[model samples]
Target: MSTEEFDPSRWDGRDLPYIPGEFSDPDGVALHDDYDADIDPVTYEVVRHSLWNINREAGETIQNLAVSPIALITRDFQTGILTESAEFVFFGQYLQYFSGTMDIFTKWIMENRAEDPGIEPGDMFLHNDPTVGTPHQPDVALVAPVFHEEKVFAWVSNLIHQNDVGGTVPGSFCPNAVDTYWDPPSIPPIKIVEGGEISTEKEDLYRRQSRTPQNLSMDLRAGIAANERAKGRIEELIEKYGATTVKGVMRRLNDSGQESIKETLSKIPDGTWRERAYQERSMTGDDGVYPLELTLTKEGDELTFSNEGTSEQAGAINQPFAAWRGTILSAANVLLQPEQMGATGGLVRQLNFRPEPRTITAPDHTAAVSPSGIYSNQVSLSMANSVISKMMLSSQDEEIRNGAMTPTSAQWQCHIGDGFTDDGEYFLAPMTNCMMGSTGATPKRDGRFANGHMWIPEARGPNTEEYEQSWPILYLYVKEHGDTGGAGERRGGNGGKICYTMHGGEMELGVYTTDAIPKTPGLFGGYPGSRGETVVLQDSDVKDRFAAGELPTDITEIDGENVETVGKGPAIELDDDGITEWWWAGCSGYGDPAHRDPELVATDVRQGGVTVETAESVYGVVLTDDGDVDGEATESRREALFEQRLDEATTVDDIVAGDEAVEAGGGD
Candidate 1:
């Protein structure tokens, strides 16, 4: 359908199809008239734990086998179990966003290949098309069907972010692309494995399109292995408990998730909460900021999210309907049902999305969405959290208000480079410095430093030693930058900074895509974090200084032929003597900085998380020479600061003054 013709309102009332081995809707629907049975509590618990453990094991298998740092180090992958009807049953604790895409892919398989190739034992399907529920090109999904008594019982799925997928850029992030055609070749929902054997032609075709064929091949194998492991575990469950009981247990799990979410919603006050977030464009000449607006309405036990006034689809930053929906679901999972298992399809059924098509949230099929999973997904997620947190704050329950989590930083900071190693090995490396940023501050506590991205808290970057060994780069230092976090009563955590230079080879090509504007803004009276930057010093005096056993702590100390500041742009070549310095953006704070404790401000200054001047100016905290807070001086300075703020504050007349007021008064 064309973007203009699509209407999300039509998508709201569609009935969920009833299928065997899947959970029925909470409205009490059945797959078949004769298929009604009660699950034994003992058997239900056993099957539930089995499914959860299977997903966990499958994730471990992927982590063990995958060669890409995105998988092994960053944990940018997920494993899940689905019913025969393609309902999500259980998923691993990896990237929470990938939890919903498996069902979409499996359902497509069932609808398209029900009688053609057919869903049979040992069969596996592969897909990565954004139109078919994938968020981006690199996140490839592999699914395998589990058979019981010659009928489909469940499906096991695995998704992983490939190192490269043959896009305009080596890492599949095409900042220069204006359309989907510029991205890696889209793979439709198709069978890549049949009867437990890989299709050589299909596998070869898939691998041939990637820039790093060897790494992609290994990731594909890892996904297949994970799916196989899930299949075996499902079969074992069937062998232990009869098919009928297993199916009943699956239904119960869904019912539990549905009831839990409904209960949470009922306790929350009914109201409409709206919030807006923006994506800073990375492509040159695209200076416009794309805004994503979200309106969340809560009534009784149902929640509806609408993106009616968001920006239209443009650039490569757009997201498809599936990704938009997934982002909302992920946010809901964290805010409402965080303590429960995410396998239940009931939560997905309970919520509704009213996204106007042609917007960045619901882009046209032809639009490029290469960065949606990391960039736009983060935007959508933050917007969702912003609205939800507002609702929680308005609640009468003190626990709920205090437990709310403000929006965190998104994936606006990244650095990718491709070059040959010292041993003549070509390498495409994505710097993991983006993963070391702080999380958003909570209502009652400060944010966590080096806490990784908000989407995947479990994400981790490789050590300096590991990076030095893997690529031809030398890390001068990697640590938290001083005065980087957003200043508040409960300040946000600080982000890290990294300095590196070529060891034995020049960086033939490099891509620096990050947010020149701060993407993570604080809530209430808290200040927004600092924006990240990429500084490159070409033909520097690093070798001479290092040879003399004098290491420069800052980039200013290094003499260079030319100094260039690359801010969110396309790929460029780097000289051998160039030094690249990257500073990650900090997370948002929770309250006004002036309300912060003087002693705490002194501690922040001592730890290098805040400058002494920032402590004095922002927090109004005067520190003594020995790094201790001067209580008497701090009180006087704070009073003066408050008076200054009152003096500089804008009055109502300033807004309605001059020509605007004259026009309103009809004086022309």
Candidate 2:
């Protein structure tokens, strides 16, 4: 599988060339003789723990050494170890989506570059092509091959989100671009290191393509260092236990993971669960909202996912095949095997995807995939969770259903700007505050508020003081928005509101890609969360108000000559008199709000999470003058609200009867 032999145009996006035969084997295939004969239980445990620790250390090393805020603050990166066959053995807890990507690129290296570049110790490969394995162009992967006894034993990999990679826009996310070429130049599997020596030409070429070359250079070095550290630790393990024993332990880990997933699947009842999610093509405005539908079929020990009725590729919102697969894998890891780290390869073996080429979930080679990596990939994961939750809820197993959370929001809004610092230095980067958002509610508990990203809960926004100290900006306010989470019995988490203004220098703010879209939808009878808001105020009275010892508690109270609501576009200028405010959408809730307890509603009111009017109207809870729950009045109000809801609801028979009844029932 040379570079010449591989054709991106011919790829259906369903199959990768490097996946092992064991991944396709669902009948519990026996291990090789060498794997079965030489490994003891104690040695296997030692090897497993050693590999996990190496992955952790690799992640910490990248975070400590990288200069980008994306790594140091938001932690938008991952490190993992893969078997010689490209199976994911140990994945760091940083970012889940990058775990599947490790398998994709590692296999690509083995198939195409094994003989050409000659895979050996100290040889490393770099690639970031969404058509092959990467989720998007911004995420670059560095893979190093480890060898013991003069043969390839394992691979260590690192992936990071570079802020600027020489794209049409300042950030790699090019919302207005119509094709892949408009984004950064795609780097195929190229040898950046050979025999412990760096390829200066390749490194320079990679860095020269970024608007912030120095930042990219630092990130590249950090990735290489992390991979090298992991490689050294793996070699140390092989030195202690023979290479054959280490390989045997890796095999045993995969086998155990397979058995665990199979056992879990057996508990789920055989059924076909269907769900549909929509993505707005606001870049073109008229392109309309496209649907990404999933029909998950569970049979015995296998689950098949089909995107049969998804919209075709039309705009920049379309995603590549790897994103669809990686997002699904990420969701499965959290939903099915939350407690395990070695089940990815085995899970991929048990799962299958039926995707149509040219669709949003499996875009063609010429389709634009950069801008939609964060948007469409998150939607795909939410769609996966929708069907997965349905299956889990329908199961008789308590543990499976207990593990489910309400559907998560996949859309993350990022703000990037570039300008001169107060010290006469230039800077351009994404605000790490974009990482803060709400998480979905669970069956028994409310969602976590501002608990970082849904995909990587450990990743969080930088502190306000730290951000202001680094950049020429003043923080007006950074706090959780009141009453923004969806209203339900068990309410969703609240998203945050951030307002900032230029301090000592002027900068150009990049237009956001996501706006006013309900990406995180509610489940059952719960209401969906509010749409995200982005507001810009030019020549505002904020400075005057600050001088007068007054600060606005809300964005609408500010006075400005020109107020604008912006979405996907090119960058715009901002002066010292300008202010920008962003309020992120909250997570979805679990149950009906009318059934919520009055005491809980009163508590929410006391905490400023719900207003008195909203409590009475939405939750049917009446609060007295002293902010205490009026139990009698609340019960009467809830009874009336329940009756009104019953009158508006349609029965299952109406849906079965089709057009006339549905039309009369006002079904959309």
On TM-score, the candidate that comes out on top is 2
Worst 10 residues of 2 by lDDT: 24-33
Local error of candidate 1 at residue 462 (angstroms): 0.9
Each model's TM-score?
Answer: 0.91, 0.92
Query: What's model 2's overall lDDT?
Result: 0.76
- Provide the global lDDT of candidate 1 against the true structure: 0.75
* lDDT (Cα, tens digit) per residue for candidate 2, span 1-668: 11222234345233322222223211221122245446777877888888889989999899889888878788988888987767888778887787777876776566566667567777888877777677788888999878766656778998998877877777778777677777778788889988888899998888887888899888888999999999999889888887778777777777788888899998888888777777776353445777778888898888887788888886677776767877777878888887776346567668876667778888766777777655787788777877787788777888888787776665666677877887788777577575776777777777766786557756878888887877788888888877878888888877777889888876887645446557666777766765666778888888999999998877788988655554565576877888888776677777899888789889888987778888999999998999999889999998999899889998878667644443222222
Q: Which lDDT values do the candidates have, in the order given?
A: 0.75, 0.76
lDDT of 1 by residue, 357-399 (tens): 6688777667787867557777777777777777887788777
Q: Which parts of model 1 have CA positions greater than 4 angstroms off?
A: 1-37, 561-563, 651-668
Task: Check candidate 2 and list the clashing pairs.
Answer: none
